[model samples]
Target: MNRCYKILRTVALTPSIGPSSIKIVGAQYFARAAIAAGEFNSTRDYASPFDADGHGSHTASTAAGNHGIPVMANNFNYGYASGMAPGAQISVYKALYPFRGYMSDVVAAVDQAVEDGVDVLSLSIGPASVPSGPSAFLNVLELELLFATKAGVLVVQAAGNGGPSSSSILSFSPWITSVAASITDRRYNNSIRFGDGQSLIGTGLAPPTIGGVFFQVAAAADVCQRNITAGLVESCQDADPFIRSLVRGKLIICTYTFDFESEAATIATVADTISKIGAAGFILTMDPDIGYEQIKGATVTLQVPRVILNNMESSSALWEYYNSNTMRSRSGIDIGFRATTRILDGREATYTWSAPVVASYSSRGPDVNNALLETADVLKPTIMAPGSSIWAAWSSNSEGDQYIKEQNFALLSGTSMATPHIAGIAALIKQKHPDWSPAAITSAMMTTANFSATPGVPILAQQKNKLSPTTPFDFGAGSVNPSKAIDPGLIFDTYFKHYVQFLCIVPDVDDMSMRRAVGVGCPSKKTDWCSDLNTASVTVSNLVGSRKVTRRVTNVGELDEKYIVLVREPFGVNITVRPQVFKISVNASRHVTLFLVATQTANSYTFGEMVFEGNNNHVVRVPIAVYVSSTLGF
Candidate 1:
């Protein structure tokens, strides 16, 4: 076993959780026994649930780690970190290793977690692609989650990393609350001031050059005596070419190009090359031909001071400044390098209000009906949360990101990061309402999410190079709102039978296939279809003329309240709700009927919403998305 397991086992055996300064991981005194579901590395090393890869520790701490723990890295203190639900207990179920994982092991972990009576399950992993089966919902992992949900465990999964593309979602089942990634209000920005007094904002997470001293800058090509072939030296990938005398104590400039993206060169390699050559720091300027630049993952961790000018304009301006200040000899060989710059501290965080935008890498919707790219009526990415640049607990020996191998914490991004936010919040909800079903908890969160950025303005999504208005396909109910969700006055509750019925009416799935998948046949009489699954949102991929929908709500609050229904119709459809206003007593249920009528055929899907304003300070929102093909049957 690894040294981390030895430490974890020692900590686990201790009866007391101790104090904040004790440096507790996710599992503490409240944790049960850690279990490994299968053998990995061809060894019976399955007994210990030690998180050597760091993903488990990162996700677990993101969900329910101890509160007010200081996040220290590289001799700098970022700040205090806390999980969404700090008081909740945690149990490790090791299923994946650093290199690879198998579905059989994941299934076993799910079965074991459910059997252990865990109230909430957070999965930051998913299939490489949509599962190949009769239906994506019929896959073994999805069915295991279905059974877990039936047993009252709320399951949350990552929507996948594929995004900004249509039908790129990996989590397509309705029972699972798939989460999408979004940018938070926090941002880290660094700047470098040239000797000419001009400054350029860039990305890095390291301290400023020591003592406010401006370091002499040199280009990798000029300092290296070797002939520049294919311009590989410009990226500082080779240490053999550099002359230690010219490079020592100088800030070196490197080029970031398509080569970096193709894995031919990497930031880790650049950092290693600069460190070995005794350079004070480095700057990575984008090659204009690389088009859009993306610097993420472990590259964020920098031991040496550095700046990555990631845009064309910034990179071009820097190059112009460098060339003007630099002096080359007549033979274009030995010359006086006069360029100088100073890097500023970048570990500090800056807060802004313009965020919660859907990340460019978060998977998008129009949940697929099967593996064939067919559309389903259900909305994908049940909700969005802060996923970009999230800092949480990490194992020092983690192999997930080599650049950050020895660090105890990592700032990462993905739908994987967003999922634990919901899972932790769900733990909070479950603590408050022990009797609520998984669907009720899901409905509470969905119906109370903030669909708009501000008043009358929709939350936007990052579409490749720009931001655009979004729909239910982008973020199901919108970004999650923890404050409004806990006291969601009414919730749309679902049961195991509802999911079975959902499969029964799937366009291409017959009762025989459904039975073969779930081992349960559909009911003899069925009045519901795919779109009428009683979720918090309404979606119709193809709407001809009109459709009638009914929703049932249960008031869980203490007092009786009256609610008024308001509608914002979609572009090509008119929506009407019956009795526009109604009152209900505590614990009472009400049925709301909605009728949608198409006025004209729309070339694309349009978005709208139905809101319920309660006298008791409760607002319930239901999103509507539809593609109108015709106003009448032709």
Candidate 2:
């Protein structure tokens, strides 16, 4: 059996025997059958028929191997050392051809993993952006996954590193468990320092003004006297030479040329050039969309130790500063460039800092459910986990390859890291209860899952930035708690039959009110598809009101024991559980009536926990909701 949350620490109980317990059906990756048959190297070439790369190797290690080490790239691996289910056996069957694109690969992989007897399939890769349903990949790759659910196999996919919004259609699918990114380390970066407190908000060089002088190189005397203005002629001015001269300390005012998103690279190039030429600082101007002679560069600040100026407005501000002293402060602002980590000596450079939160360029989602969100049905990420600066096993062995160590690993981030955690967790649950079906496993997770690390605290909506009670959206059903998941109080127990029912049945207000009884969505005005009770349950019970209600329930277990039933009020509804006692055992059952009198202002009253113990001890809670006045109002 797979050791829960211990994939990389040690060899599994029967490492030599391998994971013969789990079976892969559809995809070759999940089947590792070829390896069992002495067909391939389980770790090095998991994605066979396609040349090997390092990514798949690390993933396989955490999913099955017993050892690992860290490595860095433009990225790094970030998350727990071992995956959620270390004991679960894994095999990578190559479906999509290498570099041919993911369009056909995803479908073939899923189909074969199921065929290979894979009880659980985990996919760490996804499209770069939220996919539109109209896209070919969506129609082909994603649609095939919809069929995987019917096959009784659990499918998990990465939510995509692109934040908040990545849980949508192209990248996220309802059939797959979407994963999100979170931070493990609280400390992100060291403070940035700049030399000479006096900073400039540099402007960009435009056509005619490209010749304007801004600063003199402290080291180059003759070059300082050189009237670089002559070099500003339309025929002579090119971005390269102009940027080069500026680096040499002939403070060249220039116009901003690419997207602000590339500011980090742009500044790095200019700063490196200047440092090489003995220049102290730069006055990078932001003269976007203007002519040379007609426009003056705007100012922005560089966080580097270099004395950089920020160009907020026009060069007129600099002229005003140089020409006058009585001015307290001109309208100047600081503009910063976005930066990425620079790895030196196998670690991030000290001057370089890890980004707090996620990169702004990283897209966010589920805010306004588009195609991706619709496919996900808003069941996503479930929760965020460490996805940045990650190090994982790799495959390549070429001399000059980035991933070549016998214990090859590389750093990476994105939903890729997040998906493995869930996959591991699913494996653990399967390990513990081998007889449980996929729906039972998923239901146990969704219902019993804790929804928040900080309970009762509100997290603002990503897009709106508005503070509201966090739901499945912010921290889906609370973050994934493996320990808690192992023993969920009440499992939802849904099946594909329910999915078919959802497709065919139309629920009435009774069904509508029943849905509102649970905490999925608002009450429907009339019968609507949103009120589908097929995939979920229709809770019905009278447990509302501030007044305490008491009742009794018999224990139904193999042996005798004591049972206690309690209730905690939902929002706006005040409630208290009156003490009750019931004792029974061996094929017998009991019932409890929790009396509740909801306050007039209490809009909706929900249910709480019903504790059980003794010979048959299994903690469980039932969901019950009471609407205010019962007069339908949306």
TM-scores for candidates 1 onward, in order: 0.92, 0.53
For 97-157, candidate 1 gives per-residue lDDT tens digits of: 5544556666667777777777888888777677443457777788989998999989988
Clash counts per candidate, in order, are: 0, 99
Each model's lDDT comes to 0.79, 0.39
* lDDT of residue 545 for candidate 2: 31
What's model 1's TM-score? 0.92
Task: Give one digit per residue, the lDDT tens place, for model 2 in 1-634.
Answer: 1101111111111111134556221123322333333434535444443325445554555455442333322233323355445555665655322222333434555666655566666666655444333232224455566556666667766555444443342244444555555433332221111122222332221111122222332211122224444323111222333334434434333223443334323444444444455444433443434323211112111222222223345334433443332222244311211111111111222223322233211234342233322332234444444554455555445222321333345444545555566666777787776665566666556545443344454333333232234434443433456776676533445455444333222222134432332223332342223223321111222222333322223232235666565554544454445445555564454434444454454332232333333334555433333433432222
lDDT value for model 1:
0.79
Runs off by more than 4 Å, candidate 1: 1-39, 42-47, 131-134, 297-299, 370-373
